[model samples]
Target: MSAPATAAQPSTFSRFLAPVLLVAAMWVIQFVDAVLPLSFTGFGLRSWDLQGLLGIVLGPLLHANWAHLIANTGPLLVLGCLVAVEGAVRFWTVTAFAAVIGGLGTWLFNAPGTLTVGASVLVFGYFGYVVLRVFSPARLAHRLLYAAIALIVIVLYGGAMLGGVFDAAAGVSWQAHLFGAIGGGLAALGGRRRAVSA
Candidate 1:
């Protein structure tokens, strides 16, 4: 007798695929940019230029250079996975918020025609979401757990988070960091409202 066909099982790490894909794409883009003689920074977000607005969507995916991407990789994987813990859908959603908010803020605030690029925007977004979420969730157990996690995230990234927005370092886009965080806070509030309604 022929054996029945078996269904494929989902991997435990499937939820992490989105962030993994993001990181992988970053590495690939950097590699290609490095190998080619042409630079890709021109494709990054250009402040106050209508023609450059497309960079809002394109900017996060492009980085200035290997050093920039490398600096962003670790915290991204950590906080990104934290966001992904909700699901891949939420992960991408938060990323969208971060990109748009970060993009618009930088465009409006930075020197006209200035360029910005990198994943730090999403990093700040994810950080804000995780911290803001500590107040949400219906159950005490969940709230407490979130509180603990939030505390840990604070200890680890709090300095960088504050520094990113307030440091005013040369070549840094505090606008991206600030708006990214605002976007993340909005996402958390939106989720809380949904939970309340449901």
Candidate 2:
């Protein structure tokens, strides 16, 4: 008797679909924001406001303007795809960690009434995950490969990541960047434990 056919793995393009669709959604939302009479930015994370708590879920999906979204698109796609390469679940898990932790941290730390919005939180989160994954418990070969990838990611984004957290200009929220990175690192370490137990 012939063996049952094996399940086909997803295509490389399919693996990347999540981030692409996320960027597309950002663009579409920006278009709608521009054409409509309403301001979506108001829905973003507001410090010390009870109603603003919803921004933890909505803030990353909104942007200040086309410039803000444009600035975030490249890094989001690059770092997002890096995380997605593991699988869509990992990608979204990292995203949720970054959004919730980063948003809460920003809300708690930013001056009262300060409004924060953008995908930069996730960008920094992905950056953190990629770098910290190097230390995840794994086979030596896998750890080495992760080390190489982490090195490359650091070379590419280290300066910007540092600036995002430590040298942000007026009106920028460094708290979000710092806490987003913390969230990603936590996800990486948490995943390490899971992998060991599995």
Candidate 3:
């Protein structure tokens, strides 16, 4: 008799592909911008400009320079992979929440005509999601596991995350960091509700 089939397993690569693709897109766009005469930063979110509202969707995909993209790359990959541990859907959901909320907050609060671009918003969002996920509804064992992971994340990124929101220097958008974090927290809470209801 043939052995019964076992369930397929998710590969390590598939789990982390989303963040890799995002960073790759940013790099590719930056390359094109560097090679061409045209500038893409103009497409970044501009405070209080009606036409600039489109930046909400495009801003994180663009960056001010190679240095800016490099700075955001590590954190985005690390925290994004952590969030993606839940699944690709969950990963995209948190990203959407962070981008929209972070973008809107930046648009409303920054100086008019001020332009913002970078993946720092998503970086902050993923950080918040990882930290707050400990509070999400789950079985005791699962909650403990999440708590352990959250503690480690906090220890690693806590100081930088705080500085990002409260000690932002000139040219940095603290509003995006703060609101992106709020978006992440909301996603965590939303997960709790879904778990409880189920």
lDDT, candidate 2, 79-106, per-residue tens: 9999998888889999999888888999
lDDT of 1 by residue, 72-191 (tens): 999999999988887888899889888898889889999999999998989898998899988686599988988899999999999989998998589999999999888887887788
Question: Model 3 over residues 61-131: C-alpha lDDT tens digits?
Answer: 99999999999999999999999887788999999999999899999999999999999899998988888
Off by over 4 Å in 2: 1-8
**What are the lDDT figures for the candidates, one per model?**
0.88, 0.90, 0.90
Candidate order by decreasing TM-score: 2, 3, 1
For candidate 3, which ten residues in a row score worst on lDDT?
1-10
Per-candidate TM-scores read: 0.92, 0.95, 0.94
Model 2, residue pairs in steric clash: none
Q: Which of the two candidates, 1 or 2, achieves a greater TM-score against the reference?
A: 2
Which residue pairs collide in model 3, if any? none
Which 10-residue span in candidate 1 carries the lowest summed lDDT?
A: 3-12
